[model samples]
Target: MSGADQATRERLAEEIRSLRARRERLVDELVQSSGPGDSGDASQELQGGDEVAAIDERIAELEKLRAGRIDVQGVDPGTEVVLRFSDGSTQTFKVVAIPEEVLAGEEDITVTSDSPLGLALAHGQQGETVRYPTPDGAVEVEVLSIRRPS
Candidate 1:
């Protein structure tokens, strides 16, 4: 495995641990609230349930990612890139190692490492133009700048 692949595995494992802890906490909260006659705030319970479900989904995704081959090179989570579209419109996006991060609704626009744009960006260097296939067609984009994830 390459350094990037090992690094990605470590990061995914860390995220899984953190998410499992969070899921535990959410479950604990729900337990404390109990149900209808158990002095539970139904609204809070409902919200907590929703959060728990989301956490579970993320955990599953991360686990699958950790089990797979990590060949998405040159881009790790938090890697930022500025891309110039064919229309000359430039946009900055933070590339995440997994879809879980993007689903977390980060402040900056985010893309998964497996995404077409993300994969294309990962293999390209600064000032290089890369093409990604979209349902519409192949979209050509130029990488204006790349900030490696910390």
Candidate 2:
């Protein structure tokens, strides 16, 4: 594990912690809003419901990320890696526990650790070629480089 990788893991852990805190706060607010003493406005209730649903979804996502969170010691989840395909084309992807919306607009691709390619590349090293099952057929990709999140 490199220093950079460790730093990335630390940062991710902190993010998870922060998200958990936010979720808790949201839950508390939802409870307060739905209390018996609260005003019985239909629109307000509907809005509160929507907010709770959204917060619940976010909490679920955060839990998934926490469950799949990776350490910095290996080519596991949470590592950013570059691969060279058999056709001589290269691409970079960040191996995550769950696909993050924040990475959707980024240059690099984000792959979940449970995905075929990510599973094959788990614990892989640079210069190693790993085979993963594809829709067309099995494909082999070589690990060109591995980088931790900045």
Candidate 3:
């Protein structure tokens, strides 16, 4: 009902902090790109400017997710889930509110809230089979289990 979950909020806050730090470093690079009485590298300046702008945009986006979001829909980021493919093969994935939430961790597979598969799985219960479209076509996956990360 609010924004992102607590873990997602913390990750977003950390990401903002990291981006800000990188932006500061980029700013310093921009300042150093040109020296007194020296011609500047226009290409480098433009690239740094673009990167800074992107960072700023991302920071703004993350800042808005500082509350509860997916929980209101019955699931949250950092939720570990098991799924069975149509072939009867099973795999585990950690559900995240955003693509950026895939941090280095034990869970290598991730499902973001914005993706088609993620959208299909949202608010799904165990034993529910959800279908989502992919470039190849539609795929069906059965939810085996869903639990918060320990």
Greater TM-score among 1 and 2 belongs to 1
Per-model TM-score, in order, reads 0.52, 0.49, 0.64
Best by lDDT: 1
Q: What lDDT score belongs to each candidate, Candidate 1 first?
A: 0.76, 0.67, 0.74
Which has the greatest TM-score? Answer: 3
Q: Model 1 lDDT vs. the true structure?
A: 0.76
Tens-digit lDDT track for model 1 on 1-150? 233356567777898999999999889878987856633587778889999999999888777777764556546667888989888899898876655444444645787777888777767899898988999999998999988865
What residue pairs clash in candidate 1, if any at all? none
Q: Which ten residues in a row have the lowest lDDT in candidate 1?
A: 99-108
List the candidate 1 regions with Cα displacement exceeding 4 Å: 1-74, 103-108
- List where candidate 2 sits over 4 angstroms from the true fold: 1-75, 148-150
For candidate 3, report its TM-score.
0.64
Residue 128: error of model 2 in Å? 1.0
lDDT of candidate 3? 0.74
